[model samples]
Target: MTHATELTVIHVPVSDPRVRPLLQELGDEYSRRYGKDAHGEISRYPDEEFTASHGGVLLLLLEHGEPVAGGAFRRYDATTAELKRIWTHSAHRRRGLARRVVTELEREATARGYRRIHLTTGPRQPEARGLYLATGYTPLFDTEADPETIGPLPFEKHLPATATHRATHRGKAAQP
Candidate 1:
């Protein structure tokens, strides 16, 4: 097992070559679970959507210079960052890597001036559902309903407003 100290986090554009392996494996995993090509979903958003200049970022956790886990978030609204493409390599599962990825994304989003986060995991992805829940995300849908009937399970987390965020909203009416 790799120790946490051995892992390194780096931000890169979604188009980086190192990102390809993660995407390919993630696409294959999604295809197997949903019985359809999910590569389209992977590419649904334009490449620029995950660039830093656009209020978005993609991060990968690498060990020994090889990508082991990764995730990304795009600007959902002025105050919300929408997480997408969170994945841990199949061989690297059960190691708490996804949680690390999520934590890192949240930190990055907060630094980028976002006060909330929105994300959806496919109904077929129970592990993802658990991960978000364990990480303090509230489900936006009824958890008791059958997952298949629910389709994509939406979850959200309101980040602790940074000093910048608090200052920006100091005298303004709180947005609902």
Candidate 2:
């Protein structure tokens, strides 16, 4: 018997067919929330950015072998990873699945020697902002009026040095 508590997350290519519908749903939600222009800017993530060898990853949270939620991250700099596409099925919200995806992605970043994680969520996604803050991420751009960026509130999380090797992507060690 599989309880919802036993949901599994697997890393896959961002373009995997299993995740296509979820992406469409995400697109629809974005258009509904932030209007079309912003949605257009935010759609689509490149595949090479989500493959493992490049220190990028895409994850799908599955139940009974079916995708329920998803997220991804890519090498941002030598020491930083940029998180993206954190989405939960409308039927799956409030289930903690998105949190699990974020936690797993962070672990993957740490495992690969990333020292910090960066991400952004649109103003329409108050829940996402709250999720990040609740999970210890700090907001990066709060008071900038008339921001030039067309999408999302930027957030960052500095990972503790718990791995045998610090991340190589940063080109230099991050100051503690």
Candidate 3:
């Protein structure tokens, strides 16, 4: 087994050859948890949504130089990013990789000038929900529903503005 210390993280295409396995596994698991019919929703994300040039980003975690954990984010609004596709290989669970991914994603968004992030995880993914909560996300809903009964758990977090954010906003003075 490759040690966590040996893992390397890099930004890559959502459809890159090296990152396909992680994305496929994420889709397959979502299919199983939601149903094969849900494949439509799983596959409907536009390609540009994961393209950095389009105000989006995808990150891959490589262990022994192979993709293992991954996640992505896309612009949600002028100042909000939407996080998606967070996953860690089953063998790599409990290793804090997901938290690292979330943290990095937040930093990436902040660097890109986003002031907040919004995301949703299916109710069946309690671990994902916990990861977001543990990483400073606030639930959008008033009540937490059972994983088996709820639709999806929505969460949001406001990123602390970085120099990039401040610089970008410095020009947009409010109209009097």
Query: Best by lDDT, which number?
Result: 1
139 Cα displacement, candidate 3 (Å): 0.2
lDDT of each: 0.91, 0.80, 0.79
Give a tens-digit lDDT track for model 2, residues 61-114: 898888889898988888899998888989878878888889899998887778
lDDT of 3 by residue, 1-176 (tens): 34557878899876689877776777788888876655456557896887878888999888888877888998787788899888898778898888878878988888887878999888878788778888889998755456666577889998887665566687662110
Query: Model 3, which residues run further than 4 Å from truth?
Result: 1-5, 147-149, 171-176
| N/CA/C clash count, model 3 | 0
Which ranges in model 1 have alpha carbons more than 4 Å from their true place?
A: 172-176
TM-score per candidate, in order?
0.94, 0.84, 0.88
- Which ten contiguous residues of candidate 1 have the minimum total lDDT? 167-176
- Clash count, one per candidate: 0, 5, 0
lDDT of 3 at 170: 79
How far residue 115's Cα lies from its native spot in candidate 1, in Å, is: 0.6
Q: How far is candidate 2 from the true structure (C-alpha RMSD, Å)?
A: 4.1
* TM match of model 3 to true structure: 0.88
What's the lDDT of the predicted structure labeled candidate 2?
Answer: 0.80
> Mind giving the per-residue lDDT tens digits that candidate 1 earns over 1-176?
45789999999998799999989999999999999999998999999999988889999999999999999999888888999999999988989999999999999988777889999999999999999999999999999999999889999999887787688788653242
Whole-model lDDT, candidate 1? 0.91
